[model samples]
Target: MRILRTDIQILRAIAVLSVLVFHFDLPGLQKGFLGVDIFFVISGYLMSRVIIDEMDAGRFSPAAFYFRRARRLLPAAMAMFAVVTAVVPFALTMGALHDYVQQLLGALAFGANLVLWAQSGYFDGQATLKPLLHTWSLALEEQYYFVLPLALALIGRRWRAAGLVGLLVASLLACQWWLRRDPSGAFYLLPTRAWELLLGSVCALPGLSARLPHREGRSSIGFDSGWLWLPIMAWCLLRGVDSVHPRTDALLVCLSTAGLILQPSAMLQSTRPWMRPLQWIGDVSYSLYLVHWPLIALAKNIWLQKVPDTVLWALLGLSFVLAQLSYQHVEQRYRNLPTPRALLRQMVWLLVPLLLAMGALALHMHMHNHSQAGGVAQGQQPVYGFDARCDQEGDFEPLPACMNTPRPHTMVWGDSYAMHLIPALQASPPDGGVIQATRSACGPSLDMARQSPQDPPDRGQRCIQFNRSVLAYLRQHPEIDVVVLSGRWQYYLDDPVVDARGRFIHPGQHEIAASFARVVQQLKAMHKRVVLVSPPVLLGPDVDLGLCGQRAAQGLLTVMRTLQTHCAFERSLWETRQAKVNAMLTDAGQLADIDMIALDAFNCDDRHCVTVMDGVPLYRDFGHFSQDGARLLGLRMKLGQKLRASAR
Candidate 1:
């Protein structure tokens, strides 16, 4: 609460540096994201202390509290947004700009986390292109600030601390549960992240603070001893958790930060000569955090054009200068201005209209371009276009092309991944000649009905009906030669069999395999050729592309590269799953007297799976390939060669 305790400032510097180095793609810093958790803990503690102090003094004002927060956070954020939005169009490709613009709007609306969560499910190489990607944390913090104060206000002081503690514990437990069950959701959403802030909040309790030894000149050894535990624990955490379990590791970082905060000693507080630079950076940290990522991204692009290290260094220096200017001229100016509550009131009054105008401008630009491109009519073939009569929720819907033409090829598909394969099919027609396509979240298997029973009742019914219709279409269209089915297989593999309360009732692994076998056997009886494309090897579930790009700019292996090399240990793990699924397919193939094309080996080699080849990113995120990567793989399939063959 003071002008940053020397220890706290040192930690802030460490937190920002860890993230920066991690962004720079330094080896062995995979857990750099833990830095954000540290920040959250710090924020929680500081904010709670401020609020409690003010309330105890009988001067707590929600409007004043919020005003300070806005003055501190919004101006710099808005400035960054405006600058990035203006520059991105000129620097990025139109397609990249379109996505960046959408993200920008989301960041402005304080919903960047939602935008990012939706984007996280798919693989998109362009994710790093958005400058505001880091704003998700700011958004999360803002969202927490809004709720924490109101909850305290409602409960009154007597019950507030207990209520806050209860909420923190509950949230942390929920986050841990979700981390194991659904790490992707846990990583992207705010609820799971609330615990880190809450951890700090717990540390801020007056009783806890009072318990600390505040006596000056006592032997600081005990306090300094806390630092030893922190790094050791931090090291263990960084080494232990991979992308699949980020939130789980986040807990460790939060705990480490809390420990460090609680114990402030001369040894820990003393700024080591080497650490001074880091502390200075930490002083300018907010600005450093803002500009570093974008500069790194731009540097990487420029470096690819053969810019030397000296030039890159110069660019970094330039970025630092700009950041200093922005902090001095923009952030400090706005943050230091005394709040005229009346002016604040007027700004709040204008906020909605201003935001609406921005949103309208963005929408107009998007629609204008879309209309120029002839919207959905000009070769924009919608395989799964909204049809009132069609079962939208169904696992499979026979495309109009397949329905009217009586195509000899039967394709099973869902979502963008399936759409990616279409170009490959058109380029190199399969042996069966005719091509049939179906796309939905629900795959071709009957298991879709069981796995997603939580879908809207109508949608669930429609999904089942759609699969039935596909089977009927197979029956009617006897010429359908080959059955090529593809969906995100990994998603189905780890399907949550238990509800949030931990009750288990859904189908297990054996049941899922049996259901899949049933579908394969039924299709085989129709004498259709079957090909099962295994899910592509992911970069990692927690692979932050923006972070990756930032790291790449720092002359380090991007997260993808690090995972590619480090994941040798994980191959055996992956191979076990692959073997189980392949064995199921093999048995089904044998039973049904059909050919089962195994494509798993095509994506991997003797040691590791290739995520990027020929300068093309293989994955859009953790699982699915980008369109470019998909197209390349598809071309290899058409040529009857494995990816390894072309690599050599």
Candidate 2:
């Protein structure tokens, strides 16, 4: 019986390609992470087939099923882990090394997804530092495999479909509810993801699979013929780079895969010419998925410089070759072991080497840590001045602490960048104490979120409400004189939302100009003085200034060489990316008839922007200033003089 369909292989290819494209950050593949959802569905179907068929024949064992899953998936995973552990000393920072060891322990225990969910932000920069991050999905699948046989045995063959459907509904509800409460947990944990697997299992039920249409003749054309394109088209239209996962979009991805499984026709599946390559890729998809991410991550760390397109392509090609080798030698050899006992024995043998490698890496990290412990700075702390009790997020309601203060007539308004500037205000207060009405990610513009659909629904709506509230506050408080605006202005400029015609929509030159005009007009009408703070000197997203400080303890000359050569942002990046932003801010200030404080005057020179000032790190991360940096900036700029003048 040809139980494994060619169409299924094609789907696997699509899933792997989507994931690869997403990780590689290729254009037009924003929602490629949905590939993991597709894999979950496929896994559910395949496992259900084996369990249900065994139940029909009256032969099924949970232990035997688990052994089979281990034989099939573990060898390649352990091999990848061994390779990663060997390279960790050279490729990762000390902090990253400690974190990776923990992730390693989690992966070996089949609890990586849980460990990752608890520790790291899925989309944060830290995620890219861990080579084992992709293991979370494997961990989820392994956990599912652990429970499937037992679940099927309890339900029995005749009642399996009904039981699976009920369970699917429950998981779906749990996923939706948890998604709203804790999206990361819902995304990485198995409970919220179980419905996707069960959805596939529903399609695999004996009666259902038999009933599904499998025509070999003709394929349908146009939207009228089939709804396959509908879900995919909807995904493309709705999803963006910044969109959160496992929401309604996840449901759409799962449903689309289910729809395709039920009807595998030539029309929907690619034509014969494309099928061969896709099938080959599908055959090696498991290995490809395992190797590609770690390779990319390791390369980034090892090079410590911009990887050219040629190098990236070469590395990608190397991943494929390695995947082919692992698939041929390790996966195929162990997968064909004679008995469950034999598979378990082989897994144990493979795991010994991996465990030894991890032990060695841990020892190295421990020694490295102990050696540096004496010199490590004990009291250094990163600065974040925003407190929920005082500075606002999402809404502009004045807190008690902010109200009736000495300088209540002066306001500091912007996002998290604005919040960081609070230390400066506190260090030197103007005539009237500053009233802070700042929210993270909520800028000073009106209705900008409507044009930028990239913001989550809640955040976008909150931004709308918050900006309107700011206007309301100004109208109500005529006594307030100065309104200072600050934010990471380049954020909107660099990530401009585009329309169907490839035209910049949100923060388009005209749209931003208009938005700024409205904001300035509103402030001016209230007879308030507007003060525009220029965008801060930005470092590349990959740079971590604090981490650099830790690395530079050896000597100044060594550190300076690395700093000038490897640690700085490209000169062109500053010249070009910030140019448009500066022009807009300058134009906005002119229209508002306000004074503009250019931050780069103190932070940058003609050649390159400084990352550190007088042996103290200027930035805590890529963008935000540390406490010392903010205080230094305040003193240098004489911001008290500027605000005091606004009070006049």
Candidate 3:
């Protein structure tokens, strides 16, 4: 007989609720993300038990296992995707709509992890807008389900524990090693996460958890009470969240969850009225989890501003109602089908139409996008850089557009900050135009490479090599008499750096400032005039750069207050943040004859630094200028006349 464990239901409730709260940005449970870790452990334990028992019974079938999973997970998920697809054109921006289409396809293929891995940006702070972002976990779990059975079958029951143990150690060790280097890879991939599942697999190894004391087997009633604290304690320890992820905190949380799983149900299954609500929440947790994020994402997308706490409360209540309806209707309806054939027929009937509808919608949107962008030339990025492909991260050969009259006398160099300057440079065309030599993330440093949290261990070497390549280009091109340097200077100042000689380069303006000075001196030795463009103003993560201008332009009546959108900020705040960097730049300027451009001085006024001009957004994102923005700034700041004079 199948045992109906109320404890599993309760644990499910906690896991799903924590995830919901974390998504909603509720107070107190800051590390509610640990709930997903707990779920992984529980899922591994149950699946392992089923695979082992069925294999021993000689009835294990991959098709049957997959069909059962499909019946359990797919119906409500596809329905949500259908509705979200319908909502896409109305609520999201052009870029977001494009991303939505890509994500929708990834979700259908159960490859959201791979898509998101590729799309992972500089900061990864835009989680609220991506409605399907939570599906990465689902993708990882499905991949595990596909692989685990094969590995277990190969090893057989006799060596099950030994096999799981070996795999667990390998995965855990890899996770720890990669966390410091390629964080997103360690985070979103199956290999690193297999250990958490294997932990549960180890628990289900027949004789392992069987030796542990259960609630029903306990001598004293008080001993069973300690198990209750396990879940609570796990939630508390998860406060560090991803900072301590795939490490000790994760292990402890999984162990606590396993203990709760191993504990007998009799103590918690008592006819206690209070426990009914939690158990019910747990029963509907899967449905609730599927429905919550899209609701939150929809409000953020359409409103184009920060959602107030009051609206969030309403959304929370609405989420539960929607989840209950979905659970009662979609989840139960699909689950109650009499046979696999009946379930397959139901899946085809329900899924095919919705899938077709989403596909059609995506096609319409793609055609519309092509029409919108058809005016641009065939081989162009259309905005940030005239010929951005000339950069080190790109083709490394200057296109006609990247230079003036194809015989360039000026060189543009740095990181993405330099790319953002392309239009601004083009707007203020220098004498003989500009030749570009920029790299992404790899700043214009002589001997050291700046390291971000996302970079691999060898990223330092690659960056150093890229800088050397830039130097080689500069050496070969004696006609490039002027060099323009720009980058997100504060990023390099804030993050750690490594030198070409494999030495640790301390992160701060001191080392980077000195490095820039050396670069300037070397350029000056080549008789090239150097222009250093300082950091631009940033509105930080809280301000949605893409949405800020749109909201301001629409002049929407916000739920919070009249001036709800902050399209601009006080210059003082920016000045204060960049003081050290500005000081470093000043010191570097004194070392050689150079032109220093304070971007804030060009873009900001006495009171404010604005991101929008003439009702159009200048910035594509938080700090990178849109094409329109660069052009406007180029003209407004009189960059053309200034560059021409500076070249002389």
Candidate 4:
């Protein structure tokens, strides 16, 4: 029976394409990362088949298995790494380059997952710029390879299948539990990810394979099965990108993939004319995955620019050209080279890392020393003034810093937007100093998490707990009279909630309005004053205000803004974006004890909202205040006077 499965190759094409589309930010293709999970399943299927067949023949060798893996994987990876290391200095800030060094080293050592988990989240915007960010899955798979062969060897012939099942169940349950606690860990680490791989491994067992397909070249249940399976796979890939994976969505993808593997159709055959394109993509899949992200990342880093459709398409084209070359020159050659050429290639691989490391170190040190101000050092990511104690993710319980003052009359409560207000409040304190009860993305609204379209869904659920914590504080503290509610309210309005069935549901305007009104009335019952900070003038979602401001400082912002498709929002777009929440807040302010504060009144003109005023960058990326901007706005608005006033 030939092991070069056409079905597996086609699956590889689908998976890699999903990832490419996702990274490219092509509209309606958000769930492209599901490709990685599919890859893990494919790897497990093939690896299990190899180890099991070898063990059956009494010829299983761990060294040989690993050698095959390295030959297949490392040549393209090392080539990509060398090119990326060269791009690092020119493309990244010292702050980013510091993390890049670790990422590069982690790729070299096959531990990128651990390094990535400790630094940032997979869904985080910053992660897209790191060229080796994609390597985490590769590292994870290699780690699995190390353990799987030995694990099967130890389990013995009769019990091996049972052992694998036990592992799959345990790992999956652990993954589900851990996602609520540490989603980054659940995502990047092997413990939570093993189940998906184990699922395929179990399928590859002799008893299971016998029940599955019955033969090598043909499948028992063919054409109709492929039709049913392919659509399900596509649906899973497009469903919800923010659903924490190895979760329900990924399980669906994996199940669909497994179904196809066990019951592939005639169309999957390489001999079919239409299947040729998929076959070619699959053949170059490894190299495509290796090269695609770095090209996009480098372009972004080089210009600190967002990907326009033209740029995204351009990068995709370049990635294909480079991927084809890498596949031909390196991937195909390294494995089958003559002994002399193989030895020379090994020496080159060994020598390249040292040279790359030395060069990266020199550049990193030079940049770190000299990059005191400006350039891509400041990008679009949010910047906050307060320590992490008050504003955090996960559980709502906070440290001492959360309560800004021991006995405070005023309370600033909301999401990161509320956190930005801290500096302003500090600049002008109310009679009873403020106590903060805020969580990241957990707005002070009674319900409805401030879910970002791109952020993981668990944050929205945790946002419920965070809001309750704000209420609990209000109940315990009778002295606090003023309650300031704030957030990027547009997020909750625009960001759809992912329901139980993996469906995206927009909580209707009435539901959101009721939530704010309910919270306002509840505070009124407690005899506390309510301040609803109107969503401020925004520079649209794509503009990095700080970066834009930096360019403005150099008199280049006008030119920069003209080039950007989404960076600057016209007054019309801005008003429409905020119209719903603005209506609700206006009505809320008319109530007995509620007051609404609109910062845009002072910041915006008839034409547009100003990003920088008096040479201070008013807002951070998208729409949070930079530290100085908050203080400036506070002083300009005379916020302390309004906040300290007794009940209206």
Please report the candidate that would top lDDT against the real structure.
4
Candidate with best TM-score: 3
TM-score of 2: 0.74
State the RMSD for candidate 4.
Answer: 4.9
Off by over 4 Å in 3: 1-3, 123-125, 211-238, 241-244, 263-271, 302-305, 352-360, 363-408, 423-433, 445-454, 457-477, 492-515, 550-593, 598-616, 631-641
TM-score of each: 0.64, 0.74, 0.82, 0.81
lDDT for 85 in candidate 3 is: 77
- RMSD per candidate (Å) reads 10.1, 6.5, 4.7, 4.9
In the range 1-648, model 1's lDDT, one tens digit per residue, is 233566666677778867776666656776786777788998898888888778878998998888888777776666666565555533443334455666777877788887877665323444454566787888888888988777767777888778878888888787777765455567667788888898888788776742343332223344464556466546843674644444546767777778766655454455459767766766677777777777666554323223355655665676568768777876677676576664465445336545554565466446645543222111112222122222243444554643323454445444444554554454444544434444445555553542342222243334445666777777777776556665554444554332222344465455555666677778767875566554555433444322232222222332233343322224554566466555555554455444444444546766656544554444443455444555566677762222112211
lDDT of 2 by residue, 1-648 (tens): 125666677778888888887777666677888888888888888788777877777787766777777778888988888888887766665555666878889998999998888774311334665688899999998888888778877897778888999999999999878766567788888889999999888988886753433333333332322355445723642373335567666777777777666655454455568577888888899999999988877655444333456767887788889989988988898977878778767777667877788888878766765664213221023333535455455457777565437438778887767766776776666666778887766667775643243333355556657878988978888778888888766656656443323344556655665676678788877888877776677654655554444334312222222346324544456767567777777776666667777777766767676665665555545566766677778777777567657532
Against the true structure, candidate 3 reaches a TM-score of: 0.82
Least well predicted 10-residue stretch by lDDT in candidate 3: 373-382
Ordering by lDDT: 4, 3, 2, 1
Error of 4 at 551 (Å): 7.1
lDDT for 37 in candidate 3 is 86
Clashes of 2: 2
lDDT string, candidate 3, 1-648, tens digits: 123566667778878888878877788777787788878987888788778878888999988887777888888888788777776665555555656777878888988888888767552326577888888888888888889899998998788889999999999999989887768778888899889888888877776654332224441334674357565545554475344456666777777777666654454554579988888898888888888888888787655447778888999998899889989988999986767889878877677767777777767656645763321111112243666455554335566656656778877788877877778777777667777776777778878887654566677777778777777778888988878888877666667778886566675666667788888888878777788877567755445554555434434322322212446667777667667777888876766557788777666889777766676666665666667677777888887567656642
Q: Tell me the whole-model lDDT of each prediction, alpha carbons only.
A: 0.57, 0.69, 0.71, 0.72
State, as a TM-score between 0 and 1, how close model 4 is to the true structure: 0.81
